[model samples]
Target: MKITVLSDTHMPRMSKEWPAPLLQDIQDSDLIFHAGDWSDISVYEELTSMGKVHGVTGNTDLTMIRGILPEQTIIEAGGKRFGLVHGHHGKGSTEANAIAAFSGEQVDCIIFGHSHIPLLKQDGKCLLFNPGSPTDKRRQPQYSHGVITIDGDIHAEHVFYDSKS
Candidate 1:
């Protein structure tokens, strides 16, 4: 399965649409995961139009989004279980907070977003991934997103670009 991951889109507040490269990635993906901060339901609607979309509701998300999506959940794909969360606790280190979100869960990977920083790492038995912000990079050097291909084991990578235009 080819899974395309995105987070912190903050659309309309970020961009009206995805960049060409990211759009192509979404078009070619088998599954899509949006970590959160989507801002508008249209972002979710647009992604769903492209393919299957599984997502969480962020701290910044409006009532409609929060109502429709869970703050955290688990999804199974390609026989691997993934923990999804917006990863915001409003206190200390974002990464630490993210890891803590899935502390007692039995997920193969924890996928989250909040700081708009791309990350992929392993801690103990599970993998942690933050796809960053394809639309809102914040102070980051480049816009980015993540792709995970699962055959036997999961192979993940980040595709970084200099511009959204």
Candidate 2:
């Protein structure tokens, strides 16, 4: 199924709105996954209009908001097993070894967002994905944000959006 993947958006603090490019992807997607660090649930509410949204909470997600999201999420979609998490204890800001920790979940795919970086790779039997931060990009030269699609083949593409007129 087409999945609009996003993560690590600090929102309102980093940018005013969601990226424009992502809107198209979200519109075309059958489902949407937001890895974490939303800063507010309003973003999640807005994105749900795009499609079925599944999300988790980040480290900065505050105690009040913490109860709203689970640290890990598991979903079965299109005959695929999906494991979702914010990847907090997994590792530091940006670390491969840290992300690898989720590889052991025995899921067909693991979707996570932490460090505001997007990554997609075939690690063992699972496709690990991170859509990075749409709002809180921390100066990564790529400065990118994107989504992941899984059907016959696997895809992880960068989606740049213009939130301003």
Candidate 3:
């Protein structure tokens, strides 16, 4: 399975649409994981039009979005357990908060977003991934997202670009 991960889109506010390259990536992916701060339900609608989307609600999401999405969730894909969160709940730093969200759960990977910073690391037996913001790279050098490929083992990497337009 090929999964495209992204978050902090903050859309129509960030951009009216996905960047050309990002859009292509989304179209080509087998699944999509949006960690949140979508800000509008239209973003959900737009993404769903392209493919399956598993997402959590961010602190900045509209009420309707919050009503439809959970603050955190876990899904099984390609025999791997993925814990997804917006990383705004609980205490401490965003990364800490995300880890706390699934503290007692057995997840192969913890995927989160809140700070709009791309991250890829190993947390013991689990993988930690934050795909950053393709539309809102607040202070990062470039816009970015992540791709995770699952066959027998899982592998992930970021795809960075110079522009969001």
In order, candidate lDDTs are: 0.89, 0.70, 0.93
Q: What TM-score would you give candidate 2 relative to the actual structure?
A: 0.83
- Deviation (Å) of 137 in candidate 2: 2.0
On residues 1-165, what C-alpha lDDT tens digit does candidate 3 reach at each position?
999999999999988879877888888898999999999999999999999999999999999999999999999999999999999887798899999999899999999999999999999999999999999998999999899999978899999998888
RMSDs, each prediction?
A: 1.1, 2.6, 0.7
So what's the TM-score on candidate 1?
0.96
Q: Count clashing residue pairs per candidate.
A: 0, 3, 0
lDDT of candidate 1 over 11-129, digit per residue (tens): 88889878777888888899999999999988888889999999999988999898889988899999999999988974657778877877777998889999999999998878899
TM-score rank order: 3, 1, 2
lDDT digits (tens) for residues 16-114 of candidate 2: 676667766777888888777888767767777767888887777766557777777788777777888878764454445335645456678777777
- Winner on lDDT between 1 and 3 is 3
TM per candidate: 0.96, 0.83, 0.98
Q: Where is the poorest 10-residue window by lDDT in model 2?
A: 90-99
User: How many Å off is the CA of 162 in candidate 2?
Assistant: 8.4
The collision pairs in model 1 are none
Of the candidates shown, which would achieve the greatest TM-score relative to the real structure?
3
